[model samples]
Target: MPSLTAACATPGMRRLRILPACLHEYRGFSALRPWRRPDAVLGWGRKPTALKARRFAARHAIPYVALEDGFLRSWGLGVDGHQPHSLVVDHRGIYYDATRPSDLERLIHAAPFAAEELARARRCMALIREYRLSKYNHAPARALPAGDRPRVLVVDQTAGDASIEFGLAAAATFEAMLQAALAEHPEADILVKVHPDVVAGKKRGHLLEAARHHPRCRLVGEALAPWSLLDAVDSVHVVTSQLGFEALLAGRRVVCHGMPFYAGWGLTDDRLTCPRRGRPRRLEEVFAAAYLRYCRYANPYTGEPSTLEATIDLIADQKRRHAQLAGDWVGIGFSSWKRRFVGDFLGARARLQHVARPDDAPPTAGIRRLVWSSHHQALEALERQPPAAPLWRMEDGFIRSVGLGVDLVRPLSLIIDASGIHYDPRRASDLERLLNDTTFSPHLLDRARRLRQRIVSAGLNKYNVGTPAAGLDLPEQHRILLVVGQVESDASVRCAAPEIATNAELLRRVRAAHPEAYILYKPHPDVVSGARLGQLDTEARRLYNRLITDISITALLERVDDVHTMSSLAGFEALLRGRRVTAWGTPFYAGWGLTRDHGRHCPRRARRLTLDELVAGCLILYPTYLDPRSRRLINVETAVGLLEQQRRTTRALPLPQRLYRGYRHLFIERH
Candidate 1:
């Protein structure tokens, strides 16, 4: 029997071979190539060929070597008559040109080639099972901890210059925080693991030399798999690190310095303060609210479902490629889309899963009933008011309810209008009951209605209104064109006709503009609540209200154009109803080159547009959604709730300076 080396010396053998003869031969014979070294044989091929060859080598207990270049030359084969070919070998050490018809005839005549190939296939199958068993075995053992000392691991991949400055700053801040925390807790050992790909020189290192100077800090350069490190660490600290949330999944405490989406959840003690005042909720509740009510994950670019893992893989690959081409040191604007995709979508999902999932038990009875108070006025009211009393206040130019007790329940949020004040306390009672039965009470609905009436009457009087009305009265045929705009003094942008501006503005504007059209003008809901405009005196409110009879814009448009605004959200509501909007000043939906911009460039207003293109841009773009109080990403609904509460009360809570100071000093200052 000819050995593989001996058969290689035969004429036309190499030329006719297509797949690497070594790969084919290794697939068949186990005993024949006892001296065939694992590292010496180099395989050259395309990605698919390499994958197949690697998979085969992995199966046969043979080490696979990759050739960076010279695919055809290394294979010792060529195209024959414009057709590709391959070489195969049997366990008996017989070689055959897979492409040549005569080769098969010769092989059958020589030995049991079919039997040999079958044996090789069986071995490959066995190898696959063996590999899977080893890979999926119970997670690897964690690193041994120093006695009586907590172990902290900080994982990041920015030790290389190819990373952007932000990445470097993030890495540095983590290192600093880890060292500082270690100093505070001398018994803790701080372990910094460089990313595996970076250690392999595929990316830059995340740790610098300065990071290692701390006596307690140690840099683990080798690839110590993620699960192993996560298991070993007592707590994980990160500056927007994905591993921080991953640690949370494994039941480790996480301390975040940056405004990672996870930080606002009530699970971890956030070093940074959330901007809006919201009830501290269980992680599961937050997840349910965010996913069920507020957010959806689709492909950032396509608005389609791409699995989370696929998105992460694409982002990781793109980052690597971008770094290589651009030589790193990029700015926020350069990678804003990628950052938004990761932070807004991926990070949010991870936080929702890890932090929001309920632990084994239900929430405590007391916690379920608690409503977070936002301002000092609310706090003061809570302290002074009766246990079950309902109260409202003007805080930070918004109306807010104060106090929490068995009877002090908020039903559906109150929406006051000219017809009368209305709120479905039953709906709120149902929702409260759904969240927790112990906190729900039917009497709370009665208390809420009475409280709403009091607040409305007070608000109307404060705004110098003679009566408390429930709903706006407008003609059925009138196309209610709610012109939402920023009022400069509350009086400068009033209607020209008192009836039209008051209750008949829509009718008057529509009739004027279309001569046959009817329009209605409704005062902004914010103004009616006596929020930001509550400071205005009676003369101001009356003068402002009367001025509705003189403003020329409605007369000029010659349409029953009702001026309506509820602190700008009305613009969105009006747009939803397909009403034409005219701006007195720039609102968020104004500059999208979408609506009729009476203030700026109005190019070809004849073209009709889709609602998505207009609304998505305003809600998803324009406003940064920063919590003005905390300067963090404002949870949209929470912000809206707080703003509403503030408009009702004169007393407001001061910003949480301590939280802001800590966040800036630890994360933003270093970054």
Candidate 2:
């Protein structure tokens, strides 16, 4: 976008584009570039480095805006290092400095609380409580000490902080806050909560050590979530720390020793008052003022404008996955190439150690063992785990990648099944329970429908490699049945279709069943590329009316009237395309009402399902899709959108990857 460089020449500065350069020395600006030329200069509060910007603006006679981190700032601490997710652009003044009324204070005083805005604020507050989230989410939540005594939290802050300098606080203020907490809650246990920066050794705080230790005094030194502690406390004390504001949200009695932005608005028990902040405000009102109105949020994952609720969801999702992966993990029997991509899905916090045998996994309380789902025997053996050690089976999802996994292309989506693997019919998988027991909400069904529409509209398939071909000419007035092929020795075929497990057998059976129908045989891409097993001999190859090797599976699905398969993913894709599907063996999509199941009955999968329900379980809920670029877990729609764009640009592999794949196909497969 062109910068408003010529805006200064106009009579009024209506279109001024403010540009910030090297705003903070600690965390250099990761802001989106708009620096063609600045119509105005931007400076981060009273930081020493911002003097250059202020001087430049004064010399150039350009207007300036003050910037600070929004209340919903980041998943990491600023003092440690962070690129904030939200920023408050304050033209009036920064929110921290109490000498002047910042834009946030104005919003708090005057902004109308429309029903929609209040409703959104309520929902956001509920989410924060449910997720136990904060500005920084890396901290672990530990159980508070057991006692009958009431708990009082004394929140600490980094010394020489700007908030202290401007929020009418000093060194004596901290000591006074501690003395007040001791005197007010004499019987309560005093949890002196230190600053996160203090815990991290990044900076020193006001209350560095015990001035005079009491029997009730306990220094909270670990990097822990404030709400986790807040929930267990009866009252909170702070000298301009944000936790005092959060204590108000937690419904605790707050004693503010300094005039923090949240203080003197009839919210906190303020020792010093801001005469300008005299109006009474509800917690939701304050939240609405700070988060929804004053702050401008951008999604860290996708780098786009986002709402508070969406950012909360994003952070909560990451936190939940991180907590799961926060423990020691042992990946059993993953190939060397596959190992490189596993951590993207497992989590950045997980300490992953790949091993050859299941026994190599430490049988510790916080350890988890994961095996590739195709290794059924090993997963079966590992399932008899002792207490506290979790086991999961991993497999590629339907919308896998733009190129074949057999060709060493990294997959976008994979299923992390805590129950049995999806393809296995001997027992129930998480997908089976999802299909059997889940009450598919209208919202989810609609999402599934739209996702299916997007997939069909984009003409996307599992390995989106082939281009859409022109419709194949066939005998008129005859039903067309597509017989899908799979790797003969694959686990799905071995478990579900022992009788009709091979491509030749599947083709012969289909041809005999639909003798008059025009039959087209579509072999698995792995077999076509000579990467894995399965292909037909000369006599067996003649069992079909036509063979489709070049056209994309999506194009073939659109052209075919019906589909026949012995446990192939293409069968499910065909169902998504709204075709009549006959499963010779039990695929995950089979045994539900969707497909005609001719295989061994799965007593567990007895529920009838709509097409959308099948999609909700298999595509939406069961799989975890990771964005290769962002390394962030994305929803199916995002994965599909990425796949569509990639398919358009990448119908064929690049030279280096192609050469590498060729070498693997020839040398590795041949061996």
Candidate 3:
């Protein structure tokens, strides 16, 4: 019987050779024989490949056409429009989807004849020969300086996927290990070589900047190959970089701090464990298992054979495809699934509903009101758009502020004082003077004189509804509104400031709203007791009795129906506990169409929502936290704990300068 290979023989059709223009430009086509003809040329994005292909075709007097998924789809012969597919063209300029037999038949029928197709096939073969992979065996032999100390070399490709941001912590750990190793082997010379591709300026500077602080660390930003560096060093240290395996090939010791694909392979000493474990194997064995056994890394993004040498080419191809089909990419399975499964899909849907229908929404009758007093321009911009809930402004006056809470004024509405107050920097001086004064400590004061005059002048005497403790006995189901202010004369209602006097009227309002609600007005933690910039001339407790309610907010919130505030996190906390949040001012969470807005019209007013959605939006989506060293997103739990601790300790929690530097490097400088 004839050999089995003879059964597969067919005439006329031949394998096509596709060569990128860069191949001819760099490596000449001297190897191509006349018998092998070029069919159609292939290249990357629209600009370079198309231009080069056209030039080659013009020079050779052959027909050339651009290869693209969109061009194929225009002929109504492509798959899914966004699916990764390839094209083949004959000598007569007939094109077909090589992946499909029907497309090939169509091309054959549409073309002149089999002779022309064969000629195109021969041309492709000629191009393929020109682009054949060549062996590179010019690496130098391993060498190290004669010494008892170990020589360490750190290697990594600075370009592509190697990022210092994600690997900074591991890099720091490796640096520490390297230092310890250097101390143990005092004569050891540490050499850090940058990746040649990276040194060529394809990416930002390598991890050298992060490691520069160490005296022993050095950056080699030249065209030195990683393999050459590996030959010189006795050992290697890495985070999850590919150089670890390359160093293994060079018969060097490797210490890994992160779970690179090579980790747990019994060869290198990995400091971290792989979260997803498989059958244990050696380092080489893992590489074989990944590349040769289990994983077949075809270009899933472009549906092409993704050889290691052509990986970058395939990536460029896919990137071009992504750019071309940018809008359609969103509707694809992967992106759609991410938005649905990993994100707040339900909340997004609900928000969409709220946005679509605003007329049927119910009124937020019982929320607090807050006003922006100083930044009139900012306030005007915010007020132009109706807030999701009701918010009262300072222009509405104190009577309207109290009316939101008063039972006789408005039964179901919660009252929040939106009057803007001034934040005075000079108050710090008066506070220091009052604290040091012998007779007038914060605990003692003459309320009949100065305190009474200030309250009477401020028109707060009428809103005096007695202490929160005293008001609890009144036979009315009411909610108290606490107005917390920032600085004394700043005039803007900020929650994070250090003054309590500006918030005095808010505490008074809360006392009037909920006689039973224990209205506790705690001063800002930043403010030291007995420190007064101005004299109230009354003991804090006595003034509490004479001018306003003596209800602690902690106790009041416990029994109250809801909280009212202007952009305060207290409203967030209240919302977290299932208490109705009447935002009398605009907070980050206000316009999300979740909370009750007192400032503008309520669009999606009556829709009851889960607390989780509100929490997810505010806590997860709105704020940005930076890792102090890398300036990436900080751990949320860690940030919350830090904020809580700072609140308790009353110490400054300034962001680390390194984090700011990292931010500048990553965002501002890159842009």
Candidate 4:
């Protein structure tokens, strides 16, 4: 097959989906028509490949719809094999083809946007600006020329683009736009933004030939974020470029030299006019018609239908996580198992080097240091002799996995602490600072509440192991006190619980504290499987009234009224379940006034916190979740949904099939 660029003759078109655009999206429309056409012809907007489709449609008397990329498409470019999240379906004509009325143009002329519609449009616009989002969000921040002069931005587009050819624009039109910008503002510096296609070296642009030599002009060719470019400019000039509409949405002065779809709507200063346009409309009204009514959106991850606002938030979140992890780092003492998955959280832009110890690591400029938090010996060694780079500690998050980590099951979430790790309460961790100092906004609190409800109702826990306690004799009405166990050799237990370090000691203390309460002792799953230390002593069984085994911790939590622990994650789960939690040691979740703190009055945690506030700092904000399928960092809500779906789907399958799938996805990590 011919290369996409070779056949299409446009830079970056090689990565394009290549099938006819708008018409493919209209298959249902064609089917719903009274004529009962089950199939219809589709073509990419004005591409040469669509010529055959047009001929086939004409010959067979089938309706043809032209497909174009929507205004807000994907995070990356269509030419880079990133498919469109949104598509423009035009039956009358494509939007960029100004020779005829397009469906978008018809919507702009006919749609009556009331107050409610306009309000939504306004909010969407505000969020776009607030997030600094553009159609393609993969670009990095730009380093424009430093100056205080007013900037006049001139946009450039790829040569031979259908939008220019059909919008009554040519090489001379770009020249005129550049000249007008320079001539209009005598003291203003002219910023010539080279099109992304041109930057990718797929094609040439028109403005470069005219604006290259001018002392007042500077060519911007880097793959920089377009919103940042718009922020830097006072006014914008364009000929059939979508940046003109974005500039208008951003409240910048836009001058259009050609009759693009947005030009005739009376939102811009236009050099060319289309006589078919209707009454003057506000920016929000135009936006409501174009984005809310004339386009169709799909979730980029699932290809399911989605609203524009939701897609915007999704893109913004992805961009935010990418920005946070975009740097070089040195990894210290990550085991052979963990080495497979660390890169997923570090992001594609980061460069990571693994070193056995802090002393052997080389110091480099602008690089960070990362180490596993549970490696107590290494962490203490690092504290004794610090490395040159800043250190970051990471551990498995609260909602970890379906199976035990000792069984080689990879975690879906991780906690990254720049201060100390969350388990070590001797010093304040980042999670502590967030709880103490940061103000919790209503929106964040609401999100945290929803997340907590989901976790509680679903009976989610640290490891999500076992089924509810069953086939064991226990009292129904009596007050219950559950004692959670931990690995005796674990660093957290050694560091946090100096007074109480074993399961037997925890059980004995719980029985002493609650003399009448029914004491139930549960051992850690790792201990049950003989993977680590901290097995319950056979002689110590007499300390508690009941010994529980072969049951899910989450299910057991519901049977108990109060949970006592020396720093187990199960105590946190019990708190979420509305059971009273008594902390025997200083866990991260304890000392916040939410749990009964018998361990230590650190004096640092003097403030009382609501359940939702505690959850907000611990679950939603502190930890980052990874999508197992895509190997991308996601939020806690998405993580919950993934685990829920995975568990349900695995159970529904046959035993043999489940085993086969498990083998296929054994490692489930990225290098």
> Cα lDDT of all candidates, in order?
0.34, 0.77, 0.36, 0.76
Best by TM-score: 4
| Candidate 1, poorest ten consecutive residues by summed lDDT | 68-77
Model 4 — TM-score against the truth?
A: 0.84
Q: Write the per-residue lDDT of candidate 3 for residues 1-671, one digit (tens) a residue.
A: 21111000111111112122212222212222234345434332233324555566566665443332211111111222222212222222211111212222232223233454445334322322222211111122234445444568765444333223333233355556555556655666666666544555666434555345556666666543355566567888776565676666557898876555455546787665533343344433333332222222232222223332232222222222222222110111112212222111111111211211123333343322223233355445445646644432321111111211111221111111122221112122111222223232121122112322332233221112222343554224434443433223333244322222245544444455555653333342112111112122333333232222244333344455656554454565555444577665544345445677654432422233334443332332222222222111222222333333333444322345335444544564335
Q: How close is candidate 3 to the true structure, as a TM-score?
A: 0.27
The CA-based lDDT of model 4 is what?
A: 0.76
lDDT of 4 by residue, 1-671 (tens): 22111122223322333232322332222212233333555567777767765666666676666767788876666555566767776768888888888888887887577889889898888878877887778788765666789998999888888899889888789888898999998999999988756766778888765666899998887778888888789899999988899899788999999988888777899898888884687888788888888877765443346677766756676677677778888888888879999878776567888988877667674778888987767777777764566778999998987766766677888887889888888888888898998788675687688889999888788777777666666787679888888888776787678788887888878888778888888888776655555666786788888767679888888888899999999888988888999989889888888898878666777778999999988887788678766676666766776677666654433465445445534443111
Worst 10 residues of 3 by lDDT: 4-13
| lDDT pick, better of 1 and 2 | 2
Q: What is the C-alpha lDDT profile of model 1 across 333-413, one tens digit per residue?
A: 112222222122111112211111112112332211111122233334344544342222111111212311111112112
* Candidate 4 collision pairs: 11-202, 15-79, 20-43, 20-44, 21-43, 21-44, 21-67, 22-66, 22-67
Predicted structure 1, TM vs. truth: 0.25
TM-score versus the correct structure, for each prediction: 0.25, 0.82, 0.27, 0.84
Residue 141: error of model 4 in Å?
2.8
RMSD score of candidate 2 (Å): 5.7
Clashes of each: 62, 0, 48, 9
**lDDT, residue 70, model 2:** 71
